[model samples]
Target: MPRAKDLDTVAPDDFLNSTLKSPLPPRPIKKPQNKKIKHLHQSSNGKSHSAQFRQNVYGILGKTKHPFSSFLVKPKVFNFRERDTDEEIILVLRRHWITNLTWILITLSMIIAPILLTTVPLLESFPPAYQFISIIFWYLITFIYSFEQLLSWYFNVYIITDERVIDIDFNNLLSKNFSEAKISMIQDVTSTIIGVSQTFFNFGNIQIQTAAEVPEITFEKVPNPEIIIKVLGQLRQEEELENIEGRVK
Candidate 1:
């Protein structure tokens, strides 16, 4: 037999028998993955772009997605003045962007008309200063029109909460009509998608018949009308269940 010193220098494989199996490599320790939530939770104290607004929520609403989205599920930043402390907002909706195309096209035409015409035939008769003022006034009016249209789109909203349905008609900065009805009061919900654009964009009108002070609430040119109806239906069912349980008590 070889000396112990010689055996130690030899490769382990040279003396290996089947019984001396190599210890299995330690099992890899996997790093845990963090799963992201798709919707905002009220308790999470979410925030939006506005500093005053503490409702911030984002779900794949990246560069490709509009920040002022037409549809948001479990929105965290929206809280109407009348919102109850415990009321949880389920959805926030604005009119589909396609609805603004007509005004946007008009605005674009107005912007380019002066550039294309170079000089207005009417302005030719006026002094240079007067002509400049006229041009400025035209551009100012164009800006106002576009700004108003954007503000209307941004402020006007339809909201769905656990307990109620809300509609806000933001007519202007200072003037808005706020309307709401309890989810329990909803009697019927109907959705209508009309026109090629509406159909293609999957946006339409939602007509809600309710027993509240406002008999009917219509969401015009809103995206995902069918989904809104379905959500309402589910809420109605939940409300009915709660009523039944309350009656039993």
Candidate 2:
């Protein structure tokens, strides 16, 4: 009986030991924890850093629509004058009618003189060679007149602005004279409509006296000299007002 009792005790102990040696419930097969990912973008202030960056970029780029108004540095009070809201101004030119008439008269003479000389009974007795030479001369004169007309039209330009005046004088399309004077430096302005032709045609010359090194500025053969003078006087008055108000620079 003692031996059987001891054997039963041993078997129970071996079973308990084998059970303990066996793996425990696989420890719930714990998986490695995934690391949390951090975002690269973050706010500097309460506002988004990206939004602030875009705002800065916009200010640097400036307004695209109104180029004239953008990024203008305000002038000092003493230097300030009437500002030119419009950078460019009315640019007048010599009337096309005057040039056309001059060319037309020359062309008509060239055409009519030769025909009259050839067709007239008194001139028909002239030598054929003389007539041919005369015809060629007349055509040559016509060509010269046409060339001059083209050159005059091509090179004539006048520019007027609140800030300054520009006169581009081109003689024969090859030699050119460009003169400019500031509106503020203008001391005296004169307009002359001398002859009956000038008065009838409403065109004349305007002379401007300046304080600059160049003593005088003349606008020759400009249409409506009186109107130009008036416009200039108005601009000068505005400039004076602005100077008094400390708005011009």
Candidate 3:
């Protein structure tokens, strides 16, 4: 008999015996998907409700979610900082969408009225130079009106932070009113939702009475007034507790 070959030197068999089995194939590893990345992908379609929801919660400043925007819509961060180290924005509030309806409609009318005026025979009676000047004047007026309305809305903001609540009022481009109340100074929080639109839209005003110099801070036409009241109450309680603990320490 030939000497037995070493086990390692045996020829590999393509077909195994009926009683034998090949080793199981290695298991595949799975990758964890990031929620933010998945949200961005979903937003590509622009119809994802969940993506919009996430944007509202996470802030509108793209990946950083900083809550500030160049556009006048849902600004998450006002870029206003009360404290550098510990200040964290809990919510940024703006007037309800319905509140802008008047200005938006007026803007539309301003845009459309000029075009409509061109159809009038009165415009045809004017000289070419006069007509051109008139058009320019109308457009300039429209621009000024639109700019003023947008600035009013854009600058009017209410911000709630861990330490304080702020109300910024823009009377005009040159005039601004800023008020703040510390969380510890909050004495009473209440909200009012009146009118069919306010009720239907689920938005109203939040009135915060505080022990601060301002005494009263009102966040007008803000969305979800009840929620704001609840959050304010909770924050006030937390602040009081912190003050007590600090005194003890």
Leading candidate by TM-score: 1
Candidates in order: C-alpha RMSD to true structure? 18.6, 19.8, 17.6
Candidates in order have lDDT scores of 0.76, 0.61, 0.70
Encode model 3's per-residue lDDT on 1-249: one tens digit a residue: 553467665545523442267567799898886998976765553334423433444353223243333213233435663444656676767777678789889888988997898898987988999988978898899899889887777778887776788888889867788899887888888889899998998888778899999999998888767666666666665555546444211
Give model 3's TM-score versus the native structure.
Answer: 0.67
- The candidates, ranked best first by lDDT, are 1, 3, 2
Flag clash pairs in model 3. 67-76, 67-77, 68-77
**lDDT per residue as tens, model 1, 219-243:** 9899877767777876676666657
Looking at model 1, how many pairs of residues clash? 7
Candidate numbers, best TM-score first, in rank order: 1, 3, 2
Which pairs, if any, clash in model 1?
46-54, 46-56, 47-54, 47-55, 47-56, 55-76, 55-77
Position 61, candidate 1: lDDT:
21
lDDT of 2 at 244: 57
* Candidate 1, residue 109: how far the Cα is off, in Å: 1.0
